[model samples]
Target: MISLVSLLVAAALVCLQSGYQAYAQIEGKNDLRDNLQPNIIPMPKKRALRPFINIAGPPPESARLIPGTLLELSCEVIGFPAPTAQWLKNGEPLTEFDDVNEIMNIHPTSLARLTSKMIVSSAANGDVYTCVATSGVKQQMASTTVVTVAGNDEESLFGLEALFRKPSKPIITEYYNEVFQEIGTSILLPCKHFSTSPSQVYWFDGDEKPVFGNPRMRILPTGDLLIPSLHWDDMGNYSCTVKNAYGKDTVETFLYPNKKQFFLVTVN
Candidate 1:
């Protein structure tokens, strides 16, 4: 009976050992499975940066300009992404298609500069000009300026009446006698003159008929003519006449398309 009891005790011990070994193997396998699985971590989302304006040109003050002169308005900006610029006149956007003669120059950078230029005209007087900057972030900024055209009366009021008191023979101080431009491009026929009185200026085509009332052609208040878009029919001899009470002066110029050479170039 004693031998049988000892054998039963041994058997019980072996059963306990086997149960512990099985539990350890199962726990090791579970740990290995956990290690083999991927540990996923979520990524953070990106945010958009806002744009800012650093410098705006053509201050709020009235800009006094002589007719036929080039007027430039500029705006400078900085941002994470570059900004685009647009010009507005009298609350309306000015585009290349508009009768308004203007050109835009945009410089590339995170900090960018945009410049708008137009030949001054009598119609530009008393007009409000604005420049707007925009970015992809749905935010925009703007700046404004007022234009003032200097007339003979205004110049006289500033104690310069003697300048226009007596009529004098008109003298062409600055002119382009010949120019070669590309088709569909714009050109400026400069005919700046010097006279004692306010001169009456007119432009004539090759046929000698007065060139007026055309949307594409404009006589700037300063006696210069602007051709917004050049065409084949636009090539020919052009004459500019300035008259006053005392005398009159006449000058002629020629235009051609797709010609790279200039015969006579005069600048003032």
Candidate 2:
């Protein structure tokens, strides 16, 4: 050894150089992520998810009605998953075999549907009518006419014509000519049927087009028209057309400003 101090100094210098080499080895980047690209996350699509369970429907615009009359209940609904349907009357559930109840059909895709006529008879004359449908997560509801008993027998009853008659027709057993208001007051036209065929009846306004009653205008089971309120336009020559396999018949009436007879009123 040249000298003990000289030997120690040489060892110290070697250690320092080794440490420097290790530091210099990481010259380009100290982190591995420096050369890597950032990752991007994809977003979800903006479409309505399938199997949506939601009720879709509206209650009937009217409820009060006469016994033996037919009331219609309808609704439209969309479901992610299809749902089963159930009908109810007076809170009691209904099935296919339920008497006096029928289902027309569900839509082609089965998203919407209609209920058959809820015939209001003496049994249901004063009972409430309702329809309810249930799906996996959705429920829909609709209502039927109110059962009102007419003050008169002629205006309180409704009957269907025989469906098997070769020539079908609707027959009126009673006729009442009453003038309740001025030119605008609507009149009730009661229609009855006694035949062997399905009696298809049509009501025409003054000009022969189908005449549908407004909320203020009501058609009773006995085929009587009820005007909740009258208007000048309600005055006209109203007509009732009945058709069946046997034959067809038409009835006409002239309503004026007052109870004035058809020929008695002076036309302007």
Candidate 3:
């Protein structure tokens, strides 16, 4: 029979060789990667591996933007089991179906690339926004440097400057002069305004009467009009008028009910 000591020595040598092989394989892959350019996305590891995030794009740095304009904050997450992304404004989770927000997301593939986009209508100064990504139980966060409002004051600058000074005439930009929608579907007639003071937005019905007593219609804080769940009688010309202390503006859009599908036919 073989000696007991000799058998133990042989087993030790086998274990050492196996360990070295694993170490060499890992090191080799690292060396190869170091020699190549950065990848658009990280390689997907096995499902059993620990989850991690590689932020594709960092949040926007401190910047100046005009009021009544849209602000988009986005982030991309990559990991196993597929990570999910969401946004927080001033630490509050943003709502998707709210009046001022429309969210867009691109789901992850193999290695998992999840992208989150938030549209902030009429961004103001001193706004704090953050992006967060989560995979299972773990989470990663990205934040911005403060977005100060444009103007010259500590409390009343950037966002609410109109509250401190005399009001100026507002400028209005209409998205669509006319729109046709299928009955029972909601629509937003964008009426963007830039003004020295906060302006009042008034909407008139097809009969030229103020739009009130109808629970479905309302004006957004940004001066845009929202009419949820349209009906057949809702068809007619709608007027969007903005007024401040100094001046006023009007943008008219026609809403017609579409009972059938309309398509353009090309004849060659």
Candidate 4:
């Protein structure tokens, strides 16, 4: 009976060992398959970007005018992504007023675009105006024609007519006299000294009052004063005075309205 029991125990032990081996083999096969296979995790993708933007247009030129005169401004621009348009006066945004008018425009295309216009009266003279444009994440800016207002109307008949027609103030050439000649004669005053600063050249009759301060007179490219169609009464004592933050200096010359006159120059 004891021998029978021993044989049964050995057989049972062998069966248990075989079952353990089979289970271990199955687990190893699963681990190997997991390492050899690619991971099933999902990854994110990248996106594209938009293009750059640009703008182009004509800006306003310098402006001069008589006080109380009306002013009008027009501006246009081109750009990409369509731009926002606005106007500024003296670096400040412009608003509608009794003496002012403004217009804005925009267009659609691969390249966006804009246009603006403004109008103001003479009281608005001597003031500066600017136009600006903006698009999606982009912007552009431009200045309008600088408008200069005219001075008082009280002036000599000879100079007054020039002021009304296109009167220009005489620029101070130096603290010295300027020789002027008859209407048809050519006169040259050395303006090299006056180019350093913008000064006022006052033409006065015997009373020592100013004859011209308006824009009727134009500054010639050569730095000489050009009075287009001279008259017998145009001659007088002309004084060029420079005024800056530092101080002031005056130069005077005797001129004959119809004859050519040249004066020696001295600057202080």
Candidate 5:
């Protein structure tokens, strides 16, 4: 009986060892198969390119034109994913009006070219024009040009050329000479002018740097400088220059901050 019990215990131990070895063999095969399999990693997507403007053939410079003559203003721009163009007169979008026509031509390509044209029956003096090009992901770019219309001299009884030869100087309005405002306020510096032909308006800082086409600073349709938010650093001398075919005039103004009055308080 003792021999039979020992034999049974040995047999059970052998069976357990064989089962464990078989399980180990199966696990090893699974690990080997996993290691032999190919790994698939997803690729990253390509990014789209942003658009930009070209330097060539942007827009014509300031033109001295005659009244009742055909005026053609053209602008060309290039960018990726195509770009749209718009025309603005004195900071306002221009539309087709009586005696005025606007045309836009777009060429599709990898790098697209957009052209805008504006034809006026009779160009007037003091008309500020700009062409703005915009894309989906890029900042808008613009080009500005000023037009001066040639005025006819009534006293000249000779030829038509002599009547339209004289050019007039710019005359800036007097109301915008001095401006006073508190901090964090807004102000508009009027720079309106009168000329026999169209004139261009420009703004300069105290450091004589040109100021226009900024988010905070803009030239209004009436040739006024619009400063949306005035800070303490904005207190300085500013000048507005208006130029025409004949001559240009500059008017300077000083911006002053309003004084803050302080009152004494007694301790309670």
Candidate 6:
């Protein structure tokens, strides 16, 4: 009877061991199959970017005008994703101005441009207006075009018709005395001297008023004047004075507006 019990226990142990071996073999085959199988994740396709603005040619509405004489000052731009346009009156937002218009043109290829125009019936506010283009991607990614009205004493003339008189103070010059820019362009009036000592620089407009406080103009760290946008009245006399412990030296320059003056320069 004891031998019969012992034989039954041995037989049961052998059967359990065989079942576990078979299960292990099956699981190992499954893991091998999983590792050998190819997993392919599709990569996303890249989009073609729109052609950027060259800004090398004349803008859409490239005209010169005197103050309160323009029917309208047009600011135009080109971009993709159909950009939304806005305006500014003397560095202020479009909401303050009543006489303004916005026009948008869309292409079938998903590109677009905006033409923003404004009119000033009175000269009480200012002659400088701006056409600002808000980026389709971001508001900060933007640009501006200046629309200047003629000053009270200035004449309203087309870019070609407008004649710039020669500078009152002729050449004892170190730099270019004449800087002619388009109606809605920008230019830098450079002011520097070979002095090693620390010096102070001052800028003055044609009216003998200080240029430091103007909102439309900025003086860079290098004592250079940056006129980001140009208008009709922006044409005039500008002076840069540098003073040191030794003495003071001043240079005067004439900034003018023209239609194709710069184009001729690039061509030559």
Give the backbone clash total of model 5. 7
What TM-score does model 4 achieve against the real structure?
0.31
Residues 199-242, model 4: lDDT tens digits: 43334433475545634344444333445544565556555454
Query: In angstroms, what RMSD does candidate 1 have relative to the true structure?
Result: 29.3
Model 3 C-alpha lDDT per residue in residues 1-268, reported as the tens digit of each score? 3322243357567656665666666667767899474323233222323445655555676544544344555565554434556567778876742422332221122124444555444444666777777666677888764564555554434344433354557656322344555566666665655555667888888888888565788877766677777778887878878898899978776666556433222111
**Best candidate, TM-score:** 3
Where is model 4 more than 4 Å wrong at Cα?
1-55, 66-69, 97-110, 123-125, 152-268
In TM-score terms, candidate 6 sits at 0.33
lDDT of 2 by residue, 18-117 (tens): 5555545443344455746443222222332233333344446456554444344443333322333344666786553243232222111222121223
lDDT of 4 at 241: 50
Span of ten consecutive residues with least summed lDDT in model 2 = 259-268
Instruction: Score every model by TM-score.
Output: 0.36, 0.33, 0.39, 0.31, 0.37, 0.33
Write the residue-wise lDDT of candidate 5 on 15-101 in tens digits.
566656666666677678886744332232333333455523456667555553445666655554345556677777766431122
lDDT of 1 by residue, 97-182 (tens): 14322222211212222222333223345777665555444445454454555466555244333334434565653344444456
Q: Compute the lDDT of residue 35 as modeled in candidate 2.
A: 44
lDDT (Cα) of model 1: 0.52
Q: Residue 67 in candidate 6 has what lDDT?
A: 42
Global lDDT scores for all candidate models: 0.52, 0.43, 0.57, 0.43, 0.54, 0.48
Judging by lDDT against the true structure, name the best candidate.
3
Evaluated against the true structure, the overall lDDT of model 2 is 0.43
**With candidate 1 superimposed using the best TM-score fit, by how many Å does residue 14's alpha carbon deviate from the native?**
99
Candidate 6, 29: how far from true, in Å?
99
Q: Candidate 1, which ten residues in sequence have the lowest lDDT sum?
A: 259-268
